[model samples]
Target chain A: MADRVLVAKLGLDGHDRGIKVVARTLRDAGYEVIYTGLFQTPESTVTAAIQEDVDAIGLSMLSGAHLALVPAVMEEQRRAGVSIPVIVGGIIPEDDIPALTKAGVSAVLGPGASAEEVIGAVRGAIDRARREAGGSAPEGEPGGSAPQGEPA
Target chain B: MTRREEWQKAFEKAPLRDADFETMSGLPLEPVYGPADDEDAEYPGVYPYTRGPYASMYRSKLWTMRMFAGFGTATDTNWRFKELLAHGGSGLSTAFDMPTLLGVDSDDPRALGEVGRCGVAVDTLADVEDLYAGIDLEKVTTSMTINSPAAVILAMYVANAEANGAKRANLGGTLQNDILKEYQAQKEFVFPPRPSMRLVADTIEWCAAEMPRWHPVSISGYHIREAGSTAAQELAFTLANGFAYVESALQRGLAVDDFAPRLSFFFNAHIDFFEEIAKYRAARRIWARWMKERYHASSPRSMQMRFHTQTAGVSLTAQQPEVNIVRTAIEALAGVLGGTQSLHTNSMDEALALPTAKAARIALRTQQVIAYESGVANVADPLGGSWFVESLTDEMERLAEETFSYLDDLGHGSMLEGVLQGIEEGWFQNEVADAAYRFDRALNSGRRVFVGANAFTEGNDEDPIEVLKITDEDERRQVKRLAEVRSRRDGDAVERSLASLAAAAADPEVNLMPPLLDAVRTYATLGEIMDRLARVFGRHVEQPSI
Candidate 1:
């Protein structure tokens, strides 16, 4: 997660173990991480995303709530006319990744993914969006390169 | 010769460290320990049994391998339970979800989304029936990891055991029935401290008579450690809570010999290796001494403090999750070597999701490897007499004693004061934040390196581990099943039991256990029992969140 990337735990999955680590890592890498505590429905998650005006929304879920939760969140984003890139994280099986991505999720992150890989994916997605929008790369955003452990 | 200056001069970094630089859970760790550390070892199975409860320890039977298991419905997790037993796990540890733990039923509105989430959802005796589906309660020991509603769940277990043709005297298991720590760390609670204490004392008194083989409560320091308290804090707080419970039970007129022997403990095995081992040794010494000196608990079993240990899940990283297996293995070793009676190794993929079957099996294998492959289990307290370990253990015991004395002087070790003043005023949370921030800063400045998280650059490899997913249909099915159980049960009997529970709760001396057992017998779901109590006790709003 970059400074602009947004992170949230979607649905009633209150397990913060994964997302907290992700947030801390991304924050250490200079990404502004927002933590939404337990029991958030998809609507609240998307609403928060729009309000934060973030560059990306990271959903850390457990509780097998992802199948119902992710689609609900995507629909909530559409209904709100917000297309901020969405990234899904948590107990996501490999088979569900394609379906999640096909449902407009920018990327899918599972367990064991290094912080660098998560950073690289979010930055690449963000950089691609900026390129399509015809905006110049933010000076300190590192031109879509993955960040190392140290903040640049 | 001030302690702070003395350590500063010895270590050469006094100016840079916090005033009380120590391991989380508050053990003041030395930069290094050498020779001259257990010169004062106490007699085993006696006062200050610093080494362990029994003289021979694992030279006796090694502590039972009880991996924590519970998820989905009772029937679903019962299947998992049988699998764990088949795979060489010697005991069963049951984990209930937030709702069931809070005394709520699966079909209750508050429990809807939470049902079968963190662990299994047990709503009634039938659900309890599903949990033991085919297992014999008389032969195998079980641990129910619950509080707040511990008595209710325990009663359910008793009823289910009777139905399965096992006498209460023959059943074996532990109910993590401790509640003082619930206010201190875990936020789940049902009644005020007074009523809660009564509930626990009632269970202790009853079990002392009816369930001779059962462990009524596992006084827990595991949650405090998990909540980021220092090792010293964990030891001190857990012991203080134990003292409080003992004092409360005394109020009910149960002799120490009757209940204290059955008391057990639970602890967390964090990443710090030597520090954790010392913490366990320190705990035994502290409890043994206090039981004899403070409460005059004379029986050897009453003096001994035995515990179950779980490898720290908080230490598991979402980044490079495979590393968690390595971490869990090391932590499990620490627990076994420290003399834990049971243990649960965390899954590598835990930082991401509920462990898929592959991850869970790997977690189990980690324990088996430690128990069999690792030569450490060949002897009891393998590092017991090491000079460094002994000295650190002494330091841990001394510090925990001082901390407990400080709390004792401030007032009684009341859970309300501890949570209301200590926690709400941010003493507990601030200490945790300070430790967390220090660790974070150390990582940022390169003082500490989390292998895959920070130093290692296998940065491109994706976490290919499969994850377990639950569906909305599961929730709907649970609700439907609960509704069916409700409609088919004798509604009039259920109402009578619920009403009786309300009356019991109204009077402090009236034991709520019998009514609770009756409610479960009448097929009351967990949520319904909780709702009835909430109607009588009303919900307790938590103190302002930090």
Candidate 2:
């Protein structure tokens, strides 16, 4: 939890009620949370994520523009040579979760998913990433490759 | 320690403890208040009105069930309005989409893809024509939730009512002409603060002369509370803003009695039941005292507080969409017992989207059940003399007074400056930061219960019912309709009127009312009118952190 899993709101979903709660919730849960304020284009989110070298990325939205936005963010992550796990939370219907996951979302959290579920899902995602990579990931140190010797 | 004890400790330990937790005017609060604390909780109809605004209160009149609605194009929302009216709603509240609020045509590039998304989209007198298609504005008391460009919107309503054969004086309505809260809370403002205040005063002055029944400005705390300020912040800032407006109208050479009686307020009923009830009582006490002491107003009506309340949409959680219904019901109860003149209960689906037709009904039913089934409304100020309510109300009033003095000593009427300084120096931001921080800390520390969120959370949830989606196409179609209005109107006349508006806005001495009326009459689109004012006043440039 050295580096926060920064959650950036992408596009024009001006309603930030849920995201703010999540951001504060995560911060209190002993993780640093950097909320890139409102109306972020996917390009900006990608750039910020790479610069921060976040442990994970969370996107909160109510706007149904997720279909257009998710693919765009995934493409940027692919081009940047980072395979970071991504999570999304909002009023996303069950049917759309599969489509979102197929588009490279690691997990989808929506209505009825509690704070504990979200936190556990996030921690579980990071842990699974570590095990799959064969070790823990290092903090985003300057001029550093992904942490080696102990983690991926 | 118990959960409450731990919370008390955390609140006491907050960095801005002296500033953050204090009342509206920054009055310090003792841990407890007894008979020695201050004074009495008088009978309901007493002078100070700390107990209740009315002698009989809800024993005589239940708060009006006014549905605040408007969305999609005017035609679409008009249908919803009629439906709401048929469902036992006592009053109508109109919510104009952004284009209308900003005085821009739906099709204008700046407003494209934004029309009819948030509220009903109205472009000209024609859309207003479309909006009140079957509804009679003269009979029904309508509330227009508009600010900044309120003068133009008000003119259109006046014109439309006249065309519909309703006498201008016979028209009863409330306009959210409060621009101070717009600058402080809701960012839906067109002109700068000073010029905006001028427009608000102009409306109050003009309405005093012509539209006697019209409450031109409803000083709003709803948006302030929504902007992350607590109950006390909402009360203090709203009352202070009310004072700022009263000062402006006085400067315009209007007597306090002439306009003060019609000055109204709007508040948010968040989930905290006792806190919200205390806020309403505190608001009445502070306003009554301020009116008598500060302005020397003699009329009882001039001093009394009349307000509309809406349940806090912020308190609703998207995590358990259905649970929001309960949240709204409790909030509604608080507003009712607080003696709100009018109320709007948010629907359960608001956490996901705009209330669906079915969900919207459930919200109305919630209010109806409270009114008919519950006996709480049968007696006046039933909880008036309760030890806890009285103590909390006194505490809130004292705190609000303290906040007002701090604001005044900071710099008289420099609201933009205060918020600018607060946001920059991290004073206000830190309060919210710390409050939100502690709230999360509480949840993690198992001191708070968010049932559907943490305690009763389920896994691998399937989809909720299909939500109504408003697409870019909705905006695109709205844009097409608005463009047609622009092309068909008397172009030369609109241009002439808009030029007059520009001239009036530039001159500080000129009361921008008559000229703006001309522009609104000629059907100057929202964008055109805002464009002219923007030239004179310039758009607000929010201060950035150093």
Best of the candidates, DockQ? 2
Which tens-of-lDDT digit does each residue in B239-321 have in candidate 2? 88888778888988999999999999999999889999999999998999989988899998888888999999777766657
**lDDT per residue, candidate 1, B242-319, as tens digits?**
877787788788898789999999999998999999999999988888889878887979988999999987788777
**RMSD (CA, Å), each prediction:** 10.4, 10.4
**Which lDDT tens digits does candidate 1 get at residues A1-152?**
24566677554333444565566677777777766644556777776666555677788765555665677788976676656677787656666778788888888876545567777777776766566555586744434322222211
Worst 10 residues of 2 chain A by lDDT: A143-152
Instruction: Tell me the spans in candidate 1 whose CA falls farther than 4 Å from its real position.
Output: A1-62, A66-152, B1-40, B109-114, B190-195, B318-322, B356-359, B412-426, B459-463, B471-473, B543-546
* Best-performing candidate as measured by TM-score: 2
Worst 10 residues of 2 chain B by lDDT: B13-22
Displacement of the residue B315 alpha carbon in candidate 2, Å: 2.6
Q: What DockQ does each candidate score versus the true complex, computed on alpha carbons?
A: 0.13, 0.14
The regions of model 2 sitting more than 4 angstroms off are A1-152, B1-41, B98-105, B108-114, B412-430, B458-466, B543-546
